[model samples]
Target chain A: MDIEVIKRYLPLFSKAFLLTVKIGWLGIALAFVLGILCAFTLYYKLPVLSTIVRFYVELFRNTPLLVQLFFIYYGLPSIGIRISAQLCGTLGLGLLGGSYMAESIRSGLEAVPAIQSESAKSLGMTKWQAFRYIIAPQAFNISVPGLMANVIFLLKETSVFSAISLMDLMFTAKDLIGLHYNTTESLFLLVLFYVLMLLPVSFAGSLIEKKVRFGMYGD
Target chain B: MEEILKVEHLHKSFENLTVLEDVSLTVNKGEVVVIVGPSGCGKSTFLRCINGLEDIQDGRVILDGQTINPPLQKGDNYRQRIGMVFQSYELFPHKTILGNIMLAPIKVQKRDKNEVRAEAEQLLEKVGLSSKKDNYPRQLSGGQKQRVAIVRALIMHPEILLFDEVTAALDPEMVREVLDVILELAKQQRTMLIVTHEMAFARAIADRIVFMDGGSIIEVSEPERFFTEPRTERAKRFLKTFEY
Candidate 1:
């Protein structure tokens, strides 16, 4: 609550905020790529790979992100596989978010009626062409809200990055409180930074949803 | 007359339930053959089988002297020769009406974009939908959507067009607009195999009427004789429902 303390902590908090945003977006991007690939595998029911994707989705979705981070950061080095703390935080968040994204994308793919593909095929389109032009666009429009939710969820999950020794917002806030006993100011800044990170994503998601909906059926 | 498409002994079933049993029909070039029957009689299934959309247990669909293999490949060439319009329209919701019509020609056929767009616009005009060229499917009425579906198929210039109850989903007022498009196509000597419940339209449009019951053709006769004298007892019963 002290103005002096608030000003003093701003630079540290800003640095931490940048790190959190950087790692969060990188993880979410990885998640999207993995999710899209996994969803396509599951949708096509591809041999061997689909089963592996299914197992991966279940594994990541069922477990906690904190435990995932721990395993990636602490447990891998035990087997002589060394990964930096930042990479661990990003990978852990990505792998976990990927599963949710896969489910969201899969549901979107399914929601597109069978008739759409059938119509495309009847027009002499190959399975790939039909999926690319007819199915994928509609599925992507359907998945926007769910994907945006995952984005926000994964960003909020960056709080656990502190456990892996990443210099994210939560880690900086906790470090300040332990040093200066300025818990109120630290927590306030933490909340402020998190909102600043998530609000635009939430706003952008709705905008995309509206645009997709409008594109689907004009006014 | 030269035969454009011939279906021989088509048999289709979903698991234990038989949908089309030993259905066979031949369409000559420039012929308008209409198939009519009671609900669940496999009229739609028969069209789907001919289009290679449904897997047939036993039969052959020969188009342009080539037998169509169901599992032929990812994008079989036979399907390009057989255009189909569904009962639900099935126009791509994300695309404009012009996009819907131009897609197969440009993408699958690898035709020139400007030429396909011009042909699409002409087809849309023929169907009285040129004004809706830039409109999405959801913005249009069911009848308008069906017209777009027809134009989408017509733009392909398939050797044979199959329409499965295209007017079955439209409002009473809307049905006429769609049926009129098909009638105009028939006048142009486009070979089409149609399934419909509109008896009057069928009588007017069909060169030959195929009456089906219980997954098999009960009668195939000239429309003039079929409507007035209906040879089969089932046909007699079916035509009676439309009497009132």
Candidate 2:
């Protein structure tokens, strides 16, 4: 409960906070792009790749994300593939985020009626062109709300990275508490950091969803 | 008259139930043919097959002297010449009315944007929607949306225009507005195949009236002859449903 000890650990926590932001942002960007591609594959019912993607989604979505991370970082090095801890965490989070985001996008695809796709095709659009110009933009708008929720969950899941020694905010918080024995102060700061990260995303997502709904329903 | 579209022995079945059986028809240049039948008579399916929207189990649909079904994939260049409008007015809800009209012209025909925009403006004006260029489909009424859909189809400068029950979903007051735009297109000597329940509209604008029943055309005649002299018993029975 020493105030001096808490103050000494502050700089380290801030550094870890910045790292957390970098990892989460990078992980989310990679995951969203990958997830959109995965979503399109499933939406179009592409030949063999659709089946393969389904398996990937189920495997990642069903298991605990922590286990997936541990298996990647700790389990894989036991074999021959040795990835950096940061890369492992990022990849693990991306894969996890991609699965949920893909499903979010898939649900958006379902919301669009079959007639719309047919309309695009009859207008002489190639399948890929129809998807790119017509389907994808609408689907992205429809899925934004669900995607934001997934991202918020992803931000929290970044905590699991602490277990792998990536030195994220949560990891630094626990380490500071272990050293200073100031549990209340350390945990409170950790909570505050998470809220700061999440509020903007939540607010921005809601605003976007409102715009999409307005575009779809007119008012 | 020059033949613009030819369908030869087209047959389609969905899970063993025949939707269109050995259907064959021809449309001449600048001709407007109205197909009238009861619901589920395969009129819409027949129209869809011509554009490669519905697959036919047998035979081919030749448009502008090219087989469109299993389109010459050599380059898929033929799609640039044909366009379709749906009954639901499937305007891309995400895009503005201007975007809807400009899509096929810019994307398929690869027309210059400035030129396409000018052409789209004219098209919007033709459809009586010049003021709605920036509005989304969701902002328009059913009639306004259908007009935009018609303009979207026309901007492609298609050799043939297919109207699939264009006014079925409109309010009684909105029906005339859509038919007015379509009737105007008809006057332009566009090759048009309209599937409609508006017996009176058919009576007015159709140069030829085709009566379809059980997936086959039972009678094809001038609208005057069609109203006065229906050949098949089914056509006679179908005619009785409408008090024309």
Candidate 3:
């Protein structure tokens, strides 16, 4: 392992790391929002929308993210619509992560007893008020820790974006290995960069979990 | 006192199973009615039907001269007028005791925060839980949770209060605290339909005691006569269970 090759690759790797972060941020945020909306639609039992959401969740959950990414990035142009690779990659991540996230949030919604709504209603709250004030907050609290942990996997999943030439961290590492004829340093740095990125997120999730967990079941 | 609530020829079912069959009762304003029956005999369902939490297949629930059922009444009226407490306490766990008490008043009633908070604090004091105002439901004991649930109901200033075995979830020692709160509220002449198996508490607070079996009211009599001289065979059989 030549220290000099690693030194030379550091600038490129750092730039790729930033790209990975940017994609992860956009994809995870979109997924979280989309997932929550799907969960709410299922929970509130919207008529046609609920059916559509269920079908969407099933379709995404059952398929491979890579296949979905390829179709978006590679398949769309053949049909006359052209989009950027990053946009396609981000959309693929959002669509894929959203299905699992919907399941997680649905479980969170179920964890709240039906009686909460009944009690809220009995107190003269409107159904919308009950949902907004009582049910949604508790459900979010129940979902936050698990969903935050999911973000780590989401970040790791960004590696798939490199397949579409998105210039993410994995692509940078692979490019360097090809150019410098060095595998050990590239792989080691790749693992180290992910660790550096994920450890703080994991720590923050655990911290939030503890804060919400306090006075949750017992003081 | 005028009639505040009346259940007429009510029947409720879940899919193929009928839980309440041809049940009817009347509650006058400022009346305390105690309903007791074996488990699964539809005691709680009766309370829920009054609050419109459960749908009825037949008949109506009249509240303040207005029909409070779906076909005639808006969902808002039943909710605003009828307050209910569950066997499980059903206090919002994520909210503080004060937040649990204040939510409906502020959000639904659109009341001023300072005024509502002051009123909530007074209710907490009334329940002897003023110190627990800032506490979450999980921070309190079973008795305290029940007390907070009571305050939550009372804060709504409901026309009628329905309690579904509020003490059933508590320890034996905790039951009295909740019953005391109910009895205190009873003294203030709040209309209440309480479903409880605590016959002693029922006899103390109830103006009328309803005995139900097989989803039907077997007897409805004043507390003293019903306990001492039950008229129906079912009531006699029911009372006989506690004799030992």
State the DockQ of every prediction.
0.75, 0.63, 0.68
What tens digits encode model 1's per-residue C-alpha lDDT throughout A12-81? Answer: 9999999999999999999999999999899889999999999999999999999999899989999999
Error of 2 at B145 (Å): 0.4
Which candidate achieves the best DockQ against the true structure?
1
**Second chain TM-score for model 3:** 0.97
Model 1 RMSD, rounded to 1 decimal = 2.0
Candidate 1 Cα outliers beyond 4 Å, as residue runs: A2-4, A47-52, A217-219, B70-74
Is 1 or 3 the stronger prediction by lDDT? Answer: 1
lDDT for each residue of candidate 2 in A68-104, tens digit (9 for 90 to 100): 9999999998899999888988899899999998999
Ordered by DockQ, highest first, the candidates read 1, 3, 2
Candidate 2 lDDT tens digits, B190-227: 99999999999999999999899888888888998888
DockQ of 2: 0.63
> Native contact fraction of candidate 1?
0.79
Return the candidate ranking by lDDT, descending.
1, 3, 2
Q: Chain A: TM-score in each candidate? A: 0.96, 0.90, 0.94
Q: How would you encode candidate 3's per-residue C-alpha lDDT over B1-244 as one tens digit per residue?
A: 7999989999999999999999999999999999998889998888888888888999998888888874473554457767888888888888888888888888878899999999999999999999998888988899999889888888888898999999988999999999999999999999999999999999999999999888889899999999999999889889889887
Mark the regions of model 2 whose C-alpha exceeds 4 Å error after superposition.
A1-7, A46-48, A207-214, A217-219
